[model samples]
Target: MIAVLRTPRFLLRQPQLGDAELIARYLNDYDVAGNLARVPYPYHLSDAKAWLRTRVPGLPVEETNFSIELAGEGFAGHVGFHRGPQGPIIGYWLGKPFWGRGIMSEAVEASLDWFFSASAAPVVYSGVFHFNAASLAIQTKLGFTETGRSTLLCLARGAELEHIDTQLTRSVWKARHT
Candidate 1:
């Protein structure tokens, strides 16, 4: 089973069935879904349910996803990693209501700490759509550096968009945290 991770402001845990409603509600907003490469626009509860049902625990760290939960407010967003063709890629999203509060930054940092501690991967990969300045800012702040650019299909946009590829090496992350 995936162990729950705690931060000062929130909890990062495996996605639960109860999170479906909030996940759908948040992703339904184009502002949120549009930034994500895989989430379709007009996200529905069924989509959330189907996605949640697929989240199996005991998987490798690279395959696990975490739901970000506020103390009393419940599901706020998600942060996790998945295996990409090149390496392990990290991804995250926060509800619009939770935007600009540094919530995602905290969650992502904590997730990375847990991730690096739990695995032997030397680097983590991530990227943002060219238009996603806020998300890019969060990543850069956490020691990620741009590697290049390429287009990826944004399901919400129904088109491929320029994606800024980035990577955070274990040495860099360690330097920052130390």
Candidate 2:
């Protein structure tokens, strides 16, 4: 079965058909989409539907995505890993209202613990837009170190931006947690 992870404040559950409206509502905000690479600026209901269709249940750890539902509230955002050519890449986004409350950090930590446990990957990768200080801090706090820099297309901004790439190896994660 696909896993549903729980943190003290949130539940990382699989994205469902019923979640499309909620996902669309939060992602429609430009501020929320601006920081993300793939999310479009005028995110629409159809986009949410397409995204939901892409989520394959029971896929390997690297191929899955999750809905970041608050303990009592509904969908706040999403966190997931995509299998890139080099390795598994982890990514996440939270609604603007949920920012500055350490929610993403908690949600990510819970997912990472599950990811690292389910896969034998030596390192997991993530990247942050140079201006997204909060995202960079989250990765750094979780022990991801700078791997390099790369330019990527930001659909929301309709341009290429330099991203700070970071990686966390199994050993680094273990050291930090233990």
Candidate 3:
């Protein structure tokens, strides 16, 4: 089973079939989808369903994803890690209604706490499109330092864009948390 992670404001659990609608609703917003490298624009329910079907629990920590839920709000966003060319990569997105509230920051922190405890990976990789200052700020606040830059395809934008790569060593994360 995928372990559920808790934060002061939200519960992070495995994404369920029922969450497909909200997932589609949130990602359909270009403002949200455009920031992500893999989500196509005009995200649809079927798309969400297809993606949800791919989320298998009990996998390695690096392959797991979580759905962020509130007491009454249901699904609010997602945070998790996956295998990347350089190493394990962490990624996330939040609904528009939940933006500018420090929610993602809290959620990412909790997720990282869980991640470091569960995996022995030396570092976690992350990055943001050059235009996503908010996400970059969150990464920086969490001890991720820029490693380099590269061009990555943004499915929503349908174009290649500059990506600012970052990495957080387990020691750095432990230093901040301790």
What is the TM-score of each predicted model, taking all chains together? 0.98, 0.96, 0.98
Task: Give per-residue lDDT, candidate 1, residue 150.
Answer: 99
Model 3 pairs whose backbones collide: none
- lDDT, candidate 3, 25-141, per-residue tens: 999999999999999998999999999999876688899898999878788999989999878999999999999989899989999999999999999999999999999999999
Pairs clashing within candidate 2: none
User: Per-residue lDDT for 1-178 in model 2, tens only?
Assistant: 6798988887899999999988888889988888899899799999999989988767888887878888667888889999877899999999887889999998888889999999999999998999999999999999999989999889999999999999999999988877
Q: All candidates' lDDT scores? A: 0.94, 0.90, 0.94
The reply for model 1, stretches above 4 Å from the true place, is none
- Residue-pair clashes, model 3: 0
Per-residue lDDT of 15 in model 2: 92
- List the pairs of residues colliding in candidate 1: none
Residue 11 displacement (Å), model 2: 0.9
lDDT of 2 at 115: 91
lDDT of 1 by residue, 66-176 (tens): 999899998999998899998899999999999999999999899999988998999999999999999999999999999999999999999999999999999999998
Q: Against the correct fold, how does model 1 do in TM-score?
A: 0.98
- What's the true lDDT of residue 66 in model 3? 89
RMSD of each: 0.7, 1.0, 0.7
Clashes of each: 0, 0, 0
